[model samples]
Target: MNWTWFHKLGSPKWFFLWSKSYALPLFFLGSVALVVGLIWGLAFTPADYLQGNSFRIIYIHVPVAILAQSCYLGLGFSGLIFLIWQMKIAPIFIQSIAPIGAVMALIALVSGAVWGKPTWGTWWVWDARLTSVLVLFLLYMGIIGLKNALDDVALANKSVAVIGAVGLINLPIIKYSVIWWNTLHQGATFTLTEKPAMAAEMWIPLLISVIGMYCLVASLVLWRMQSIILEREHRSNWVKQEVMNNGF
Candidate 1:
């Protein structure tokens, strides 16, 4: 063990420089996968015998839904790192990611509703999974609001970290809501222990789409983190020199 690399990530300047190098490649790969997957799934793959073309929304809905929970998990993990190691980069990641997580949650909800309309015969439902997802969305909003409402930077970061840490409970509930109770929402699309129930035509593109979405989110998070790092470190000489030399 070498932990030196881990600690170096705590440095704002180091992480900013690292992210800049990787973000563009991530965005390019993600965009290509997303476009190809969406096109293949929507036009080429045979529609579900039961759901017909309506099932196409799954290409977008499932990935964002997964991202919603994953982003919060990242937030919570960052909170813990900040609380334990007092890593400066952790709180920056938290602040930079909260709004993006909220947007992901909102997209998941809206896409779910749109998918639900033709399938469930209504735009809304009080089903267990749906309600849990709604709660997850609210939790993200609450974290965002908490961060914005505080006037003190240190206090705000601590408060947001605590909230993000506590919010971990909701993720499991969101995950198991379908199985824990009778619900209109479907069960897991794919899992590690079990083969996907979907045909290869469906799940293959979906898997690609999921990978694409994850890459896209990573790229966006890196871009945002770089911006926030710049803003917070603006008074530092290194950052000033960076701005002057690079106009970034």
Candidate 2:
């Protein structure tokens, strides 16, 4: 089998050239999808019989919550690749993604709290799922703090990679917390094999929002990875020449 393409992913110059073309298009499509989804869900879709407008927060909350967990999964995978294969781009991927994931986790928690207020009668709860999500946010912050504390690039990369890899255990706990314990949080709204629990009017917009969020995250990650590559590879002639030509 051909492993050449996979190996080229390790080259900062190659990745930068490849990703530069994708960032803008992804951002554009993501913005359009997100806007369309939010408007359709908030204004057009009928409100829930029980939760009313408050339930609409699901459009934003579910997608970001999903992304929060997914980003960590990606982070852990990149960390493992870095540790095992010493891929140069893997650590950069981790560094670029950590803060974004942290923000997503924060948004999920806050949106969940806002949605909970009208439905659950409170802003916060010590439910298993909620607590586990909080832990996920803290894990992101910890990785960021750990990276910042170390001045040595190599040491910082190794330390954060180890932490990111070890943090994978939390992902399963977060996913199963609603089932493993009696939690106020509800079960999954949308599943792959089974139909969505909600009406098509509701779930369709949600599906759009999730796809938009994923695209936006991808665009942001690519843009960030490009910047980090420039920062790390600035001493190389390709980086210097590219920067000079592009004026970035």
Candidate 3:
């Protein structure tokens, strides 16, 4: 019924001011949650009957993997918004998120490989899921590379939006890889429709860790977005006034 707040987010001034309210709080909360969850998962939880202590890596691996996929989906959605609505904030979303998504993909890959070492007897593989994920990583890199390589900001944003939009195809492939084909990687850890196969002591910390990671990602994205907004809007009157009065 009310699209007022939605359009308000399109304003760099409003969004930047609004973000200041939550960004630091999220940073502190996310850091605390991540620390507590990692400590609990790594030290307190009992080892898996099958995988033993090695399963502890799951605490980090799964959350980053989830973030990797989820972030791209958000990127694609932002791309759509930019392309259709010509929303100014949309490109800022891509600029802010692309690097973070790439880092998350890298974390997922390295952690997955480490997890694979004991489970699959190798550090890497050409398996479908792994390859698809690598492609996702490249997609993020492509967005970053495309943006940086272009001389024109508008053109760069448009081109990267197309790439980000097209890359949405990989999300489903990465998601269903283990189910679609036989793979060394394990299946879903927890799903809403089905009870988790893990014990409370295990999945509870993992759930907390995932939330923490999301919070951290939000903090980073907002921070980056704020930086971009300031730089892009530096020539605007509000920014000039802010710098003159606030000493920023």
**Which candidate number has the best lDDT?**
2
Worst 10 residues of 2 by lDDT: 177-186
lDDT of 1 at 31: 92
Tens-digit lDDT string for candidate 1 (107-203): 8889889988999999987666567678888988898888889999999989888888777755676557644665565676769789888999899
lDDT of every model, 2 decimals: 0.86, 0.89, 0.86
Misplaced by over 4 Å in model 1 are 173-184
Candidate 3 lDDT tens digits, 1-248:
99999899889898887886798999989999999889999999999999989989999998998898889999999888888878888899999999999999999999989988997789997665566678789889888988989999899989988887777755676557644665655567879899898999999999989999999999999999988999999999988877797685
Residue 123 C-alpha lDDT in model 3: 97
Q: Ten residues in a row with the worst lDDT in model 3?
A: 177-186
TM-score for predicted model 3 compared with the true structure = 0.94
Clashes (candidate 3):
0
Candidate 2 per-residue lDDT over residues 1-248, each given as its tens digit: 99998899988899999889999999999989999999999899998998888999999988998899889999999898899999889999999999999999999999988987888899987666567678889999999999999999999999888988877755676557644765565777778999777999999999999999999999999999999999888899998889899999
Q: TM-score each candidate.
A: 0.95, 0.96, 0.94
Q: Sort the candidates on lDDT, descending order.
A: 2, 3, 1
User: If both were scored by TM-score, which would come out higher, candidate 1 or candidate 3?
Assistant: 1
